[model samples]
Target: MLLTAVAPAVWGTTYYVTTEYLPPDRPLLAGVLRALPAGLLLVALTRRRPHGVWWWRSLLLGTLNIGAFFALLFIAAYRLPGGVAATVGAVQPLLVAGLSAGLLGDRLTARTVLTGLTGVLGVGLLVVQPGARLDGLGIAAAAGSAVVMATGVVLSKRWPAPAPLLAVTGWQLVAGGTVLLPVALLVEGPPPSSLSAGNVLGYAYLTLIGAAVAYTLWFRGIRELPPTNVTFLTLLSPTVATIVGWLALGQDLGPLQVVGGVLILGSLVFAQLRRRPSPAPVRAAGGPAAVQDLNA
Candidate 1:
């Protein structure tokens, strides 16, 4: 779990990197460069291709987890205040908890629901500033991002990969990058004719560290940890982002923000304390085989 926590924590740096180093108003291009090269690198290293249903499954998962999620998130960032979009996206843990109950047969307790709500409230306090304007389209996009990402998390657990972890992650990245390539070209036009050393470095950080390493760790966490648990870790992203801003960008670190950060941390610990049920026994052919709950 500590290792899994690293993924979102590193993701927090993206905001700082984008604002300070990346070119202005070119989110799609950033997404493409971030996803595609890292994906191809992984594929090259693993030297594995999708087999059977994975070709289509990879595309669907890629769309949900990466392509669509990134697009919608970028739209929200453009249209809504970052605070509002993040607060709205906080509903992801709740969505994941409910989905786990329905699809994964995990028990949904009052504590879990309350904890999820606490996370949302904490994020709202931490980020939502006074008089932050709202755009309906941005709210929709943020909500959609939450839904799609939650579904992707559940579906990833529902469908275990036959291939190795890097291979599976590579496939999703490639598929997502492929989907993003055209949208980026059509909407954003070609990449910038020239990039500075800083721009190059920022893109490289996003690709190698942000997507490649972080996602590998994230997918490993999904395979090893509870889905609800994994989803809750996302709250850390904003928390870390806020801290980075305060420390690095000289943003204000008010009392309320401190309180909000505390709440987020407390909620994360509380959620992790939930008691997981034991895996059920399964009989295969002649012998008994245990059907392990991967989420457990």
Candidate 2:
């Protein structure tokens, strides 16, 4: 659970990293760099490559998780204002709730549904400004990214991996990066000719901490915990991002966003409460509470 919470906190840095460090025009390159090299390094360290069924699984999971998710995320960020893109992405928990029920046979508790809805409402409050114009393409991109990420989350749970968490994450990154490399080349061309220290450090942070470290923790936690529980943790990302934005980048947070942050946090706590296991039933001298009452 700590890992689950921390992973998204790290991920919250991505919005800043992409905008500040990486070239604005090369979103694909950013995605590729984030996934591929870190993945290969993990693979090399583990010396455990996927074969046969695992290869297909890695490809599918990687595409949905990293490739499609990152591509759409980059596109949305490029096309839309950050707030709008973030709000669209905030729909992820809702998507995960629905998909987990269908794919994992997890019960869709009413409390969970309500909490998730509240979280969405909070996100709306936080990001949707009055009289702000909408970009159709950007909305689609962010929404699509959420769906792809939801699919990946469900599939990853459905298909258990044999490799260690870090190794599996690495393979998925490699596969995602490989798929993106050609698309990036054809569509976005090569990266910028010159780079700066800040650029290198930002990219390194993204690759090592964001992709490698965070993902290993994420997958491990997902494998151990329920999908809804894991998804609920994402509520923290926007809040963290907003804080980081304000503190690091001097972005301002309005009253509405602050209220929204409270709502999101409340909803997350509520959802977690719903998912927590109840204490074991206690037996009385006569019988169980309902049973004893019936007898009495």
Best by lDDT: 1
Tens digits of lDDT, candidate 1, 136-168 = 999999999999999999999999998999999
Give the RMSD in angstroms, all C-alphas superposed, for model 1. Answer: 7.5
| Candidate 2 local lDDT, 1-296, one digit each (tens) | 87688888899888788788777788788889989999999999999999789988999899998988888888888888777788888888889989998988988777777888888888878766677668899899999999998888889899888888878999999999998898899889878899999889988998999989988888887899888888888877778888888899998789999999999989877776644588996555754776768668
Instruction: Please list the C-alpha lDDT of all candidates, in the order they appear.
Output: 0.93, 0.86
What is the lDDT for 142 in model 1?
99
> At residue 287, what lDDT does model 2 achieve?
43
Candidate 2: worst-modelled 10 consecutive residues by lDDT: 281-290
TM-score of each: 0.92, 0.91
